[model samples]
Target: MNQPTKKVLSLFSGCGGMDLGFEGGFSVHKANLNPIANFGWIEGPTDSEQVLLKKNRFETVFANDINPDAQTAWTHFFKKSFGYSPTTFRLESVVDIVKRHKAGENILPKNVDVVTGGFPCQDFSLSGKRNGLNSHKDHTGKIIGDEDIPSIETRGQLYCWMKEVIEICQPKVFVAENVKGLVNLGDVKDIIQKDFSATSNDGYLVVSPQVLAAWKFGIPQNRERVIFIGFKRSALTPEALEALSMEDIPKEFDPYPKATHTKPVKKDVPEELSETKLSDILSDLPEPDGVTDLSHRHYSKAKFMGKHCQGQGEISLNGISPTIRAEHHGNIEFRRLNAHNGGKNIKELQAGKPQRRLSLRECARIQTFPDDFEFVIPATGKTRKRWDLSPSQGYKVIGNAVPPFLAYHIARNLEEKWNLFFK
Candidate 1:
């Protein structure tokens, strides 16, 4: 009478964000902000929110990440929720996993139903050096990085490893997320998709990739990432399969998972009512305490770690945040009060400080991580080296995560549409 849970194997699963969405056992915190200038988190996910993620029908059987701090954060949340450690293996490289399988080892089970990952994006990031190898027909018409792909030195070739896993495990559906820059990075997108669709025995339908904005999918931030959602030809209905080419699939699945929220520019549009803002998410979060020590644990004291040099900067307390970045640490946006305490700015409030940095929990909330998801970064510590990071790694892991809330909609859409194949 009930369907069995579909198994998932995740790669590059930093902190289990994607896997958590697939498992679907947590609920996020929510609240209403009124009177405009509120900077408090009136609500956070309840301690028991994990009990509420059962509205979906999938489970993560295996997950892996290179960062141990990410593993710490990953294990910390699941252990707290499930009362046992999850299957997120650490210290294992995707290259090694693929090699082991090719060398006649069973790194992953052969019966995965769905596979998902947000592979490393640094090489393909337009903001970065864009050092990955690509066709010379790019905007600049020159291959910036001639480094051989499949070379472990650069992360660009890691997609090859991802493809290898998909080829061997042969899941019915596979979804990959990456920066928008990838689609336009000359031959990088073409090479990866061609490799993905090349498998004859268990090939994908190679649906046209769509770049999705997180805000459109209910996330408060204006993050945009390209999504590749492909259905196995044998797993779709006859009519859906009739239009299953790289070009045709987009027509059939047009507006795949239509936006539930929007931010219209016109002040009169009805959709404007649904636009989420930074105030919507963090207004109720506790404001940062004024502390100037960059070494301090809590984001109490904001730091201009590299505001001028790295292009990382601050965010106004009353506005939506820019893209939450991985390496910025506190270099990125920190909320500052407009006027308070006899009209003193955040700088004067904290003994001549300029602004206040957000705490780790607040950052997680910004990443749409449920309050109870539990980033392992300590509230205060002399040194967080035990977790393989300088305490600031919490922000890195949170920023690098796939935002489980967004992944939830993607996974839920697939489960509803493709579970018929599994059943």
Candidate 2:
């Protein structure tokens, strides 16, 4: 009998974007469907329950986070709601978790085929300090913003920890997702190359980096992320690699995905591909409210208005939505309507009213989350309503997540090779 399809173990599995992408497959349009079943996941931070619900993509065998609050949220949601009590590892860092597994302190599920993650990008981000690996001292020395090493403190060396996990797990295929800046970091690339070389100390080869845009794969967002794929030598034949390199590899595999959507303007095309406009992404959401306070009274008034008003546009009524951002809660740009024209003034445009920011639901939609997925907001003051998380946090999460559709394409392209050569 043929062996069961490869099992997956996801690391830094933020809301399971990479996991979902590999599981659902990718498409150029909404009509196309490709689904891969039989995968499991592990995510850090206990607070990922909302993220998991939003993606609603894969089964999780392991979930871990250093934050007690995040773990609490996960246990409450997954265990209490679905009776799926994921192995919860608290106190231990990701590296510690990997080490424990390696030393046989904890047992991994059977037949883990692929390991994936979008590791922390703070140190490698343009907005963050440019400290690469050498920042470890600063991180450990309790140096203000640099202390927390791989977890909350210094994220510079987080990739190193991820590499350790890959080394210890030794899965057949390992996939890493990170900000595009990672490829630009000379030291980061060097470290990856070195670790990859060591991982393949035998004869296996590692392919070059591939940067992909979500838009080209059918999602409406314009997010770009870099992917590093390492295949084990023992899992592949020379002929298979040759076949993969020549025949089936995607056309725009080097620096970006091919542009499936284009604009008439030349300035629009960067090294990354472009797709559906903001109008295309959010045309379906309702108009923003014109209030500006933290009071539930204000929010209630706005909600009442929204419910009664005809609203400008039709509800999206589709599965896809634009990527959500944390800034949506307070930013004028995020609140602005998608009209190609009209609305001369801020007031006319509904720019910064009280409830002007995108709701958590709207933010989730923008990030391409399914409608039924939920986020837990704490109830505050006289308003028993849970206070939605900061729009900035939403932005960070969505901006950093791998677009599932795009990931699906890469996985589909690689699936045959995974089955024939790796298996």
Candidate 3:
């Protein structure tokens, strides 16, 4: 039987990570897979192994983001992988899109099944200023004019716009993602959840939000994001409605994906599947000698400011990487530090490679974007196309993205029980 594709509308979609994961049909390192939780992906060769994940039952009918570089990267990857027309991705702010939509512009597609958005997270990110709902930047990331008051249009409150899209599209389901720090910032998580539940006169039943750790889903980064899932009450079956309303969701009806890999703990876990190490994913790549792929050829050249500051620490090869920040310049962590800088990865140093920050390719791999998803592009190179995205742009987009591999797990979990949840 042919599985029906769920039409998805993506908002605030930077570089299409969630879109790619939901659509599925991408290659990833073998270490990113679990033997117990097979999603019907094709395994590659034992030597330098990879896994080609089966396409999911979801299709992104529409995608939107304000960032031009994100559009460039997303357009390039989507066109190459799935033959999607550039028109499928709208380069507009959700706020503008929603306002135009409210004004009777046919900007949004009809019959969207799933709505997904990782709304602007910087304000709520622990690594950031923790602005929460009182952000000073407008929807396009520009600072609000001194004359204008910070309102729902501000970056921190952009999820409200995403909520607005949900009200307009009325998808059966909607998934909103944000930085984990939102939970710590004084009832902000509750406020967002409540706002989502209030959609269309309490038309949606929102499950309690949960923070998903990327490392748990085989991503080689210590990234975590809180996810909010809301189901259109009228669209759900009776059992699903009852099950989902419970304080503790029954395992059979839980929408969250099970953890595929385990992190290290003091006590051993049964059948403990070790997490994928950063080294396992990156060991095969030759040093960025400017002769390899476009992503590997360039990296952040920000000098280390020392250990006290963020992004100055060196990544441990044997362990997962620190969270990839949506930052560039001096904020990108070093791939290796020199001896004077408390350097590790002595083997690379001995091999005569220079101390450098993680390359665009390395960061993308850590985020589980396939090797083919080019992040960096030089203005003049054989790999250069019509786009001129700099390394800074690459780092920003990559850091802002949800890990596609982690999104794949969410997609598969939803796909596996779609019928059970919906009418």
Candidate 4:
């Protein structure tokens, strides 16, 4: 008998990277350039996204995000590129969605095989001033600090909605991803774990959180996120999560995919990691952006005033790319590659003219976004136009997304091993 595809309820699904990874029907854009150690090309050089002939193994029943821009970008990718419209993606705040669902006005499904999301993390991030839950300035107009996260208002409270969704949908499996800072941010981790385990139904058996680095998992960027997984307390069905025996739930979730590609950091260990470099992934592409006059970083008033941060540092072609950020387009983004000289680092040769910021395509590549996976935003989202971008929607969507390739590896592990939890 043919097995039914698993359905996922995705929340805070900005730009659908996790959704696309779980729905693994598309081919990656392979970079024609060579790899550092013959791992693989950055992305495939195809104009159109390749589709899997067989039906996808997993389906997204619902995807929600508060931002209209993200919805627009997602709609363009699916509707314009794939010729299939996904009403599965709805633009609604998770808080409102849960309230409406509880009130019997929402259309979300009552039962789902899995639930997943990278909840709003600005509250618990080490960066962004560690605002925690207090998003708004106080009556004194001072921003709240780490001590105030649990008691603050604003986007920080949205994470509790994740627990609420678990309460309502009562999925068999649930996974949540967040910034690494969540583990150290006061009592945020403990609070969230307790809330997540306290689902309205029978609650769940939560696993110890683990930090997964994107670079360790074939992604070029050095991005790290803490992952949380939970299984329902009691067996619900024969094919449901009950497939995993209660005696072995923790042991099943204990081990995860180890790093396949890594840089040689110590003398004892051989380089198992691919050590995918920025030049290897992005060198084949055409220039996406440039500033003729402001190309080179010079010793000047503006350079001094800009007070460039870590992301602004010039990246070497030989190393992993920096983490991609959402808001800082020109500031934190990487410098453009000089593909002509055997894909030389822009800083190495001191390119005669000037260095430019990475284009949207390059940023997408760093985030493991397939080249064919198009971005249609208010900024330069088209193929022909790359430079002179005042990106409002495009950058945020790309930066905020979980790399599809990274998510794919995680989903693939879940697909094969979820049964073993019972075995």
Candidate 5:
């Protein structure tokens, strides 16, 4: 039997959400059940703690981060969990990685089957400044530092960097994910086609962009993102492209699967039959204290004090959560039970008032993170106390991630295509 092809890499990997979804293709032990496994190697730097908590085992290679604070947190977590440092992981900036690779100092490994990433999307987000190819803000919204501002050639050019990495790595298949707004960026579609056309690699065909909803997959959020898949021109046969061109790819991709649970718009429906609600994701979560003073120089742990814990009006367990936002605080507060209420839980609380804001754990749950996944907190001596994770950071990470279930479906489809093409 021929050896099975193995190896995968991810870029701009935030909290390993995309990596987890793609890894679902391989059989993994999940709470006593073994699911199909997919990843053999994973890379990227953000949220390494969450990735380390996963039961799946694979060679983790090539994690990178530009932020020193993020790098420090990642290293601390890796040391605490794995007892050693990761090989091939770098604390260097991504631009430096590209430059080194371009200089022929770092050659990517061969026969890598897949490359995936959720590149920074602020420049391309419809909800953002609409700067298109000239945004000066980084993904995190800080004004571009005086020293880091880009020239016209590099402004809003991160997508071009992704394209460069793909060209250099030459993976059999690549998946680039971004906000749905990426499709509308000034002449982006034409630019992508033009860029791909310029490559000499044969049979490389970019799949039409797919707008996928997280709820359709198993995630309990209504996030939508655009996914672009490309097969090396050499990997696709002439017949496949001919067939794809003839058959309208978008038509086949439409009518995406429906959410397993749908949220109810009215309170008249029976509570038992209502779709999933915020309470379902947060009922077991501890309450949050209103404490917000902490030094930014070091990680600090905060105690979870029972402040508010009630669900806003009637909620369903079957539907998706409202979109989590970083800046939403007052109106968007998730409802929590009033302490004065005799009821012990949110469901028993009186209806009609706005719910308390969602806790970080609840946000994580809604984002489809496993209940046991650990978020890094400040450590005191040897014990790491559970500080109330920052709601803003949680919101940013959750808001930015591609729903794992959506990624799973996309990966599964691509895997099928790989088998068919390589057979």
Candidate 6:
């Protein structure tokens, strides 16, 4: 009966990957779980190894990010997995923490209960430059300096400042996220779902914003984003505001998350729900030159601008990678490509293993991050002290994160409908 934790707060929390999927105990890869949703907070070994998971009931307590290598890989992997307190991660700039919490400066945190974000999807990225709300940068991702003048803190309206931090932290669930090309960009997902159902005053209700698909949850990659969520109209429950204002939501009030890995659709699936392949989590990594795990001894020599570029080809250890893009030189792709540029792994080019690229622990294990979460830390003695994160900032905060097993199935579908949608 130890339930009560639920605090959260995140917000563009890069290196924490939706705060390690809402504070769940880590260690993924047993072909990314789901022996038919038997997830009783998982545990160790067997479906062929790895497992663990456990920990949930949320927690984070607050995290931010203007990215100093995402606060040094989220304060060194949350002070080694949840002992946190590196001032609980606040490298500033959610527009200067909402202008220092609107000038009064108690700067947030008071009964928060979930707020999560992903917010800066590079102007609604379709591999960027769509420039939705005309963002020339600001909100600290820089650029706006032509004598500045782009309001509502740009970066395509930072989810309207994550709907003003869910109208000043009144979070009975918030969520946010972006880039499924912000729902085809035209109305910028119906004007950010009508300014997040006019939050605080309109009292919030939101709902219709889905997308998901990180290899349909088991996260082998090919990404996709979109989320949103909302909720707090005086904190739900009138039968969860009529099963979340219906239009389909009644799978026990669906807070979205269902596809626990799919793709091989051929009638009643269940080869442990298929999919999940990029060699089922990098076929037990070992390559990376004498790896003493400085994020697997680093990679990306870059030069392979061919096959109609854009991370120039290669990846497909039996399909599932592609979208891990917070990008870095030659856009980081190949993990083997030599046969005159079309190199399809042919057993790692007859086991010679050369033409590198995807390392930074194979793009943080294809974005499900967790080789004891240490994305490169090499600065050391002789008075030099500077490299706590480089492999180009660990491939840009593991391609701007959020694949902690697709945020642990959206935080285990909101901790399994939080008491049927709040009291």
Index of the highest-lDDT prediction: 3
Q: What ranges in model 1 sit over 4 Å off?
A: 31-54, 83-88, 134-154, 246-255, 271-273, 288-297, 300-302, 305-307, 337-354, 377-390, 419-423
lDDT of 6 at 7: 92
Q: Candidate 3, residues 48-97: lDDT per residue as tens digits?
A: 56678888889999999999999989998999999999999999999889
Q: Report the C-alpha lDDT of model 4 over 1-423, residue by residue, as the tens digit.
A: 665778899999888888887776555534311134324322333453222212236777788897776786676666654454668788877766877778988578866888899988776777777756555543223455666544322576666778888888888788898998888888878887777877778878776667899877767787899888887766334433543334444544442454566666767654444466777665665443352221121111112113235444555667777778786444545453345423346454574534456556667778877656555333444566443322545677788898887777677667766665532
TM for every model, in the order presented, reads: 0.80, 0.65, 0.95, 0.77, 0.68, 0.35
Write one digit per residue (lDDT tens) for candidate 2, span 1-423.
Answer: 543555566666554446556654211222211111212221222242222311222344554444333343344445544465556324345666766777877555555566676766655665457565545432223344444444433446655666666566666766777776777888677576567646733433456767666555546554567778777666666655664455345443321234345432588564233344444444444543442322211211122123223232222323333333222223312233333422223443555423233454444444555433334335456875454433334344444556555666566555534445553
lDDT of 4: 0.65
Indicate the worst ten consecutive residues by lDDT in candidate 3.
Answer: 38-47
On residues 52-104, what C-alpha lDDT tens digit does candidate 1 reach at each position? 33346777777787787777787777778755455545457777777778898
Instruction: Please identify model 6 stretches exceeding 4 Å from their true place.
Output: 1-8, 11-16, 19-70, 73-105, 109-114, 117-168, 174-215, 221-233, 237-239, 242-249, 260-276, 279-316, 319-346, 354-358, 368-383, 386-423
TM-score of 5: 0.68
Number of the top TM-score candidate? 3
Error of 3 at 48 (Å): 4.2
Cα RMSD to the true fold for all candidates: 6.7, 9.5, 2.3, 6.8, 8.3, 19.2
Q: 348, model 5: CA deviation in Å?
A: 4.4
Better of 1 and 3 by lDDT: 3
lDDT of each: 0.64, 0.48, 0.89, 0.65, 0.51, 0.82
